[model samples]
Target: MDGGLMLAESLPRTSSFATDRQRGGAAFVERWTNARAGVIGFLTGRGYSSCSIAERIDDRPETVRRMWTLWDLSAYGHDGRAPQVVVPLSQRDRAHLAGAAATAGLTIEAYCEQILVNSIRR
Candidate 1:
C-alpha cells in the first residue's frame, strides 16, 4: 500500500482503457490516484466489493457507487440516505461520469448499491 492507499501503477495507460483526466494539474493527479486505488483494490483483495472498488475509486461509498455508473459497471442502487443532499454537475462532468461508469462495467445506481451491500458484510 502506498500512503495508506493501494497502488495500480501497472494498469493500462493506453487509449482504450484510459480514464477521464485533466491535461496536467492537481486535479489530474487526484483523479489518477483515485483510479489507481480502484484498480489496485480490484486486482488485490477487493474485486468489485466496497473496499476495493468504492474505497479505491471515490473514497466514499456513495461516490464510488456513482463512479461505477460513470465507468459503466452497472448501477448497484441507492442507500436510502435521508436529507438527500444533491451535488450539482455540468454536462461535461456528466459525460466524464458516464465514461468512468462504462469503464468499470457498472451503472451509477447499481454500482453504489453493490458497494453498500458488500461493505455491510466486511
Candidate 2:
C-alpha cells in the first residue's frame, strides 16, 4: 500500500482533464482512484474518527463509517501478513508532521509513508 502511494505521488500532476480526455480515461481513473484510496487510508490510519474524516474530505459520515467497517473486515483476511506497526514520535514532531500532511492534502500516515519511502530510495 505504501509502495503504491509512493509510486502514485511520483507521477506528474500538471496535465488537465482535457489532456486526459484526449488520451483516454485510464490514466485519469487510475490516478483519481489511487489518490482517493490514499486519502482514506491516511485519514483512517492516523486515528481520525470517521465523522471527522468525512467532514475533512467533504463526504458523508455514514459513507466514511461504512468504508471503515469494510476496511477493518478486509484486514482480517490478510492472514497476519500485514501486522500493524507503531512508530512513536514526540509531540512536536507529530505536530510538524500534521502540518505538512495538511499542506500536502494528505493524511499524516500517507505523508509519513511517502517520506519513509523517499528516504529509503535515497
Candidate 3:
C-alpha cells in the first residue's frame, strides 16, 4: 500500500499510542528495533544481502548488517499469523494523514496497525 494511504487510514488510531507516553519507552523502542531486524533477516533468508536490503529500504549498509546480526530467526515463525487489512483513501486525505502520522512519530504503516489493534481491543 502507498505511504499516504497507509497514513490516512491510521490517523484516527494514532491517538491510542500518542496518549500512552509511558509505554513508548525502552520496550517500544526494542520492539520496533527487533521488528526491523526481523525484516532484514527475512530478506536475507530469501537470498537478499544486507547491502541489497539497505538499498531497498534507503538505509545504510552498515546499519542493515548490524540489524541482520540482531535479528532473531525464531520471530519469523509468527509472520503467517499476523493480520492484514487494507483501507482506501483519496490523495488529499492520505496526504493529510501522512502529515499527522509524522507528527505522531510513527511510520504510516505502524500508525495504521496501531489504530487497527486499538479498534480491535475496544
Candidate 3 wrong stretches, greater than 4 Å: 1-78
lDDT tens digits by residue: candidate 2, 1-122? 45223333343333222222323545543233445556767656545556655666556778766776766835543222232334777899899999999999999978988988899999
TM-score of 3: 0.34
Query: In TM-score terms, which candidate is top?
Result: 2
RMSD of 2: 15.4
Estimate, for each residue in 1-122, the C-alpha lDDT of model 1 and write its tens digit. Answer: 54344344433333212464665665543354554545633543323444444443445555655655566543333332221223346789767877877788998645555656699989
**Model 1 misses residue 52 by how many Å?**
5.3
Ranking by lDDT: 2, 3, 1
lDDT of each: 0.48, 0.59, 0.55
Off by over 4 Å in 1: 1-29, 33-48, 55-58, 75-122
TM-scores, each model vs. reference: 0.27, 0.36, 0.34
Model 3 agreement with the true structure over 51-106: per-residue lDDT tens digits: 56666545777876565455543365323224235466789988988998899999
lDDT of 1: 0.48
Clashing pairs in 3: none
For model 1, state the Cα shift of residue 78 in Å: 15
Compare candidates 1 and 2 on lDDT and give the better one. Answer: 2
Model 3, position 63, has a per-residue lDDT of: 77
